[model samples]
Target: MSQTPPSCPASVEDVFACVEEHTRPLSVEAVSLESALGRVLRERVIADEDQPRFDVAAMDGYAVRADEEAEWLEVVGMLRAGDWQPQQLEAGQAMQVATGAALPCAGLRVVPKEETERTGNQVRILRRPADTCIRLRGQNFRAGDQLMAAGVRLNAGHLALLASVGWVRPVVTRQPRILHLVTGNELVPPGQAPGPGQIRDTNTTLVAAFLSEWGLPVQSFRVGEDEAEARTFLAPHLTGNQPPDLLLISGGASVGEHDFTRSLLEYYGFRLLIHRTAARPGRPLIFAVRNGTVAFGLPGNPLAHYVCLNLYVRAALQRILGVEGGLAFAEGFLTEAWNPGRSPWETLCPAVWKLESGKAQITLLSWQNSGDLTPLRHANAVARLPGGEQPLSAGSKVVFLPTHPL
Candidate 1:
């Protein structure tokens, strides 16, 4: 391991730009209609047939041919929804039609049942019906109409439209296969009592949850503190027949003696893109790529892990999948004053915010340090505080990134 100190940390924007420039969108795959929700569409979905497919009744009424002064008409037939057979409507004749039923005769106007009196196949018109109630063929959409454009993230409504257009499966961008390696002999699995100088392995859970939220598959493994053991455990995964598209290493990314993640990745021919970022809570974040697979060495601290995953990991995934990614920021006023620390790095402080009378009111959570995760339980957002020693007062406008939408 040739270890001069790692390269100087880069700005957050520069890191994002570098990752975006290096990562290419994954190829396409065919997924079942039911499984396509939340996946990015790779192909434009065009209508296979016109919506409605035929002229149909839009209301429950009587289908009749308009005449100059026809006050009474003979009831010839009845049509309900899904009835497609054609029925003729002669002069002075009408047919009972239900909503969504195909019109029995061409050029016939439907008079709502409430506008006419009906008794024993005989009907009396009470009012003149305006325009026809028949929904024309292709009224909603034509056969060649584009229903959904490429690169759109499929949602419930989009799936409904696809089903309506007879798409049982959709072409979507293939989601990356992610494998996580959480290291540290001092970390014990959750549900087990931690020994002295030990803590629960929360980073794995955090990384897994974030990956699931981003619509990626999660496969994880636990490794011990030995550098040789860690290297041996990860070597097969790096050069397998079906290696993961992305590798996430949690806990061993910093400059400590046990922080061999970067060195191991370098040994495997992975080129480091950015070894560190000028951001608080996650300055040791490392990004590298090799053989078309990207690896992110996230910090071990739980709070730092959360921030780096949200900021950098999420951005890399979005670029790889060709989907809209990055933190969505909203302008809001701080409910209390905040004094930025003396560190030169930009700080991301946890906050809880809500809309009050259409205005965003934000309150900074009581944060002890980046190692503390308790404050995040009540925080839905993080306020980006500048590096200078200025104290931002209450009611000051600040931009915040929501962990979940407000």
Candidate 2:
């Protein structure tokens, strides 16, 4: 008799609740400014000074006091970005302030370069119509104000903001370390010759690449064959001197006789959080944790693994690390309807094209076998379908999660 799949767990909330109960963040480490990219901030970073640091010029022109008679003032001295003016602007004199130069207190207005004329130390202001080009001190942000709250990832923009606020040295949480294990019996290492029935190992490479994109470094390994050999290979990596913040195992998550990833997880002292989900292609996904490290068991198929890695596994990792705002999902309407051969639940297929009309049109990638990876390259989004007996019509609205989380 066919065994019924484990109960659906009521909803996605229940699955996440179980996942949250088992997983926790890894220990924190300190890194320098250059090494802080992709790491989360552990503490709130306050600005020590204003962003502009002074009332400065927003254009390369003359800085003069704003009054009815101050409009035609003469340029007394020039102030470049790094130079300072020893004398402030007098009643009839203005200082030449370049873009980003600090403005003296006597200057209250700035005329843009295109709107002024200069000869020697003298200048004529043309467009002093209003207070248009003065970047006032503390206008963008003030000193002692919270610039970036904790849990923000340090990206290029964040770095620029921090530098503007005089944060030469800042504190950031260390990137989460991952231990990746690829398990299969018919795999061959890259660059090695593969005979019939053997395929090159792509899982390890893909997993490592994906983790690296998220600012996480992976200590990855590969194992082959059944339960005993797989468990033995993983024993060292999972229990070694540098145990991973997250353990990712690809393949051997299904119910086949050789699929020992789930069973052996219990052997290695992990509590199963969720054995299955309602999503297609990655329905057999599993999550577990031991000693505060999350273990994610992904489907063996490359495309399926690709989907789950971004959707479920990434979510679990971000939750523990206190990282926020990195999750990405897209919305599109279905341009073409599809039906998988023999599944009760709706399958999330890779979208081939998003139409000019803003509709998502896709069919199963040609010859899309579970293990085939050709579809992954052409796919950019995972189109969703609600559970129902009737087939969906074209142009139907649906939600999709992008494979690239950025």
Candidate 3:
């Protein structure tokens, strides 16, 4: 007799809490600024020198003493950017200053060229200078000031700031290595025609691509339906020198006769922290950790695998890296009605979301099932629907998780 699949016993919030409680940031390594993008900072960065080190002109204008009331002044010299030598400004003397050029002396104010008229070295002030147009020394940032705090994910802006602060090499958390195991008897490699009940293995490729995009080192291997063979294949990854930080097992997570992923994991001393989650399209998700190696047994369906990876696997990676992780949710109104079945688990419906006339709107796609991947092509976001007897109507407010960076 076939056994019934076990119901998901963990809520979404509970699963997240469990991940946070168990996961710790990986060890730190010094990486050059050129290769530090998207890496989490392990040490706080301090400014080595004051930004603008000296007072500089904010506009292309003439620098003069604020106390001078002379309507006309003689331009003694010109100061271009990078001219560090100080030039004295007499009571009626002025200097032509370019934007970013250091001010000649203290109490000097810049008069924009547009507000003054010049004939050769002589210039006439057209209007009273209300603004100084001067960037004071250390105005942007002072020396020894905190440039970036620890635990920040370095992006383009962060990298630029680090470079500005003279940090050519910054300490960052090391990326976790991943090993993907594709298991199934009826699965065939891609680019080949499937015979009989066999289907091409797409989950491995999908998981590998996701890991690669995240800049994580990943390796994939195939395992047949036999539990003994699967154990042998996973044995090398479970323990040894340079073992992977995460083991991603595709397929064989459910309570089916052919499903041997959970049993094999147990045999290898993997302790299950999360057996399942109360979320659709990923109900059979499994998370286990042993000896600092984390493993996830994802479902066989393509779309289900994608959803679970985004929800669970990504969370685990963020936790291990000591970086904050969560889907970017935006508020939008439904353009059409959607009513999936009422269950205890929340439903996430794929949808196309766009901004029209400065207003955000989302339309639910025509979904077939978890196995269908066609709908994902048109889906840029996933709309969240609470589990209840009531169906969502058009114009109802909802929150959507974006698939791509918005």
Assess candidate 3 and give its lDDT: 0.82
Q: Which pairs of residues collide in candidate 1? A: none
lDDT of 2 by residue, 1-406 (tens): 1123255632344555666666665557666677777777777888777766677788888777776364456767778888766565677888778898888774478778888877777677766656558778788888888989877778888887876665656666556667788888789998899889998988888898787777777877777767888777777777787667788888888778888878888888887767787766787888777776788889888878877776777778767777655455556666666545455665667666556754555444543566778877787766666655667676666677766534
The positional error of residue 376 in candidate 1, measured at the CA in angstroms, is 2.8
Tens-digit lDDT track of model 1 for 282-333: 8888888887898889888989887877667777777777675554678999
Q: Can you tell me which runs of candidate 1 are displaced by over 4 Å?
A: 1-6, 65-71, 87-91, 105-108, 125-134, 324-327, 356-361, 404-406
- For candidate 3, what is the TM-score? 0.91
Candidate 3 colliding pairs? none
Off by over 4 Å in 2: 1-14, 68-72, 86-88, 119-121, 325-327, 340-342, 352-367
**Model 1 residue 360 lDDT score:** 93
Cα misplacement distance, residue 311 of candidate 2 (Å): 1.2
Candidate 1, after superposition: displacement of residue 149 in Å? 1.8
Query: How close is each model in CA RMSD to the real structure?
Result: 2.9, 3.8, 3.3
**In lDDT terms, how accurate is model 1?**
0.82
Between candidates 1 and 2, the lDDT winner: 1
Root-mean-square deviation of Cα positions for candidate 2 versus the true structure, in angstroms: 3.8
